[model samples]
Target: MDKKLIGAIMAFSLAGSLLFSGCSSKNQNTGEQTAEESMIQDVESEVTLGEYKGLPVTVEKLPDVTDDEVTDAVMAAVENASVTGEITDRAVASGDTVNVDYTGYMDGEEIPESSVEDYNILIGSGVFFNGAESSLIGVMPGETANISVTYPEGYPQEDLVGKNAVYQVTVNYIVSEEQAELTDEFVSQISDCQTVDEYRQMVREALETSRENEREQNRRNAVWDKVLENAQVVAYNSGEVQEIVDQYTSYDQSAARDFEMSLEDYVQTYQGVTMDEYTAAIEDIAKQEIKERLVIDAIAQAENINGDNATDEEIQKCSQQQGYDAVDAYKQDRGSDGMAEDVKGLRVVDFVVDSAQITEE
Candidate 1:
């Protein structure tokens, strides 16, 4: 897959253990470990762990949330609760949001994909081709106009690149939008607060709690970074890396099928990369990910917190944290092996963080 897809899969896989399933343990039904599990076990045995315990790391002290931050957050909440209403009294202008019906034509031939009705567009927003939306400025509702546009170079559709096209556009109406005013009544409507003062306090407290969580995460990251720096992979497993690449390829094919598009077109449209470029990078991405997993597995094994030993409560909590309704649901989507790996990886990281010698900056 392309960089975007590769980054997404790698992030989700490495973030906790939502992707990839392999452990040294055997399946209850088969009584034999799968190829992936065997490969992971081999890689883990080959890894040379660094001095993870009491690793020295520095962390920044948490800062107090200021009143200005609280006010800004409250304003953001109010902005999110803004309203949009239709207006037909005035002519469309720059920066006005207009609903339009349009059809694009190139050399008297209609561009089928470019025809849309009741499409909401912001003037000068670049959502439409160059000057297409801007041309609607000064046009009153119910009026129709023809605007000429030249498709820019490097357009997604090769046939449309640098081609001159005419858009027949009809303005339906302008959308008038405004942010809600911060008042006692508005605060009560958007939140449980009875007044602005209560809302502000709530926002401040939320900000403080968010910052503390962020500080704790930073400390953990610092500790892990030091541990990884000290560790080394003595032998690289090509089989393990290829397994991950195959999994990524399968996911890419499934995604293409879901979008009802060819794999080449899907990669181009969603990932902004040619199929060849995407294929070239998959191996490297898989290698990096497999390396990280092997290190995590080795650490977990050394700490006696392997996936086979994860508790049911730990699994449930991990599933809930990852947005699953329950442990069974998580296992249904991402097998029991994947769930165990997630719990085991998290326990290892927490153990390393707890054992670190951290100094506040």
Candidate 2:
């Protein structure tokens, strides 16, 4: 998960619902396999109404895929499905940390909650806010933040314009993220692919595909913005607050070259003069990610669109598929599977196809 990719996805997710992220935002799984089972049992009654018998069905609001907006997205992906980055900047190492500062404000207010200073953070640690740390990784210590943007219109504060909120950030630390010395464990990360290039390509495609899907979601959400203006979207946050804290640490590692430094060295390397400065920044980003995730989950549930399903069997397969002794380690955080999240994304895609009057751009 490249930070750029994650940042792009998060931004896309926030912008979408109708246009940026297709449905929901990024993912965070922790004890979800176990938690979903319990959640499922608590409300078994709801599903009794009847399964759609089609088993693994694809529902569409449109009559045909040929002339529908869905195809527009598919065709766009097919046309642009290729890797094209020059790696303009290469880091001395993936696990390097320097110094950094950020001026975060809510809307137009110089609110401290929105601002953090001299924040020191580990490169691969899930300490900074959404996409921020990841994006900052490859950058030089004196460089600006990789992912900077203004708060969106629909964001919490009415005062803040959803324009780009820029920051002067630095890469306080750098470590070699070069793939593990092609060891059994390292090879195992991409066991799903045949070769290293394949592995990288697969990862690249996964990222591109995610962005493409989010775009479709955004378009669909836009249609819904007009259609479901008054729809009672759920506004509750379920799931532990710390769940984010623990879950991202691992994901952050996955995004960068699995940071080479220990958490302590990683933290101290960042130029942020104070611990509060560094931590507060990460806290804000993480919270935004949470909000984006829940929003998508809620929207997905309202519509019947389904994305990837994490059934007990799928979990087991993922475990064996990756040659891991236990699949649980990979997805120890998510809950009840992302049923709500999948449904939201699916429905939004379907809605856009069903409603939007698309003309090729």
Candidate 3:
């Protein structure tokens, strides 16, 4: 299934936001409060959509779940698929597993904390720099060998970058891997199924359900795209766009914190974009998102579709289920009106999907 369409549907249909961690300020002027409050309180009445109806859309054909696909899916769930082989006397070779004691040295001095006993390394795994794994090839058990290699420039460790290092390596033992066979016992261990045939059937049914879901999402995506293409935006509020921009900014700052770098450094180093460039790009994304919301709102109004019918009791129960002690706290974090907006958008999308003329290929 296409992740973009799945993400779009989830974003519009859900009430929570990953980017925006803060809620809009409460409006004081509007004494006559309405049920449908736009996300941005100040710009609630500033942006409006003109019309949305009878949009042309074509849905693609649903993907088929082949026998090979079902087999692959079932095999992926098999427990203890690989087993270590009996100890072998064969020389260290590619694909062979070995245990060894190693000590690394740099500039003729043993590096502190660079020695390990009974360490495991898979031959030809490319887990180390040049010649580290290849140097162990053809070495017999209990044999000691020396491997010398230079760390490449721009290595993750600042001090070790471009440094020549030597390792005193010893081969402990070699072992091969044996794959587990497919049997009733294996099926019972991995899944609820008791037999291989039963497991295969279960995989087929699961694949069918997944395919149907993807087809439904594709239909919704087609409907939404066509609706957006035909919809007209009579006016747009800059404040609304800025609200979304703030979300992007907050998310970026959070990500930068995770990377142990300032937002500016993170953007320049990882993204190759300056803060100004990122802000401009984020503004465009925010505007596009706002436009989609406006279109969904217009369609909801046109079709007389409303999903914000949850009672106060229902809201309280939902809040409790979400681990909030009080409904007010839940409303504050998720926005009191966000649920209504999500419900309305979902209803509008449902109408679009139900009414769309799907042309399958």
Q: TM-score of each candidate?
A: 0.56, 0.27, 0.55
TM-score, model 2 to reference: 0.27
Query: How many backbone clashes can be found in candidate 2?
Result: 63
Task: State the RMSD for candidate 3.
Answer: 11.2
Assess candidate 3 and give its lDDT: 0.65
**Model 2 misses residue 129 by how many Å?**
51
Candidate 1's C-alpha runs over 4 A off are 1-7, 10-45, 60-62, 82-179, 256-280, 307-313, 320-328
Model 2 per-residue lDDT tens digits across residues 300-338? 555545555546654553333223455455354223353
What lDDT would each prediction earn against the true structure? 0.72, 0.42, 0.65
lDDT of 2 at 6: 40
Ten consecutive residues with minimal summed lDDT in candidate 3? 18-27
* Model 3 regions more than 4 Å off: 1-52, 79-178, 272-276, 310-336
Pick out the ten consecutive residues of candidate 2 with the lowest summed lDDT: 43-52
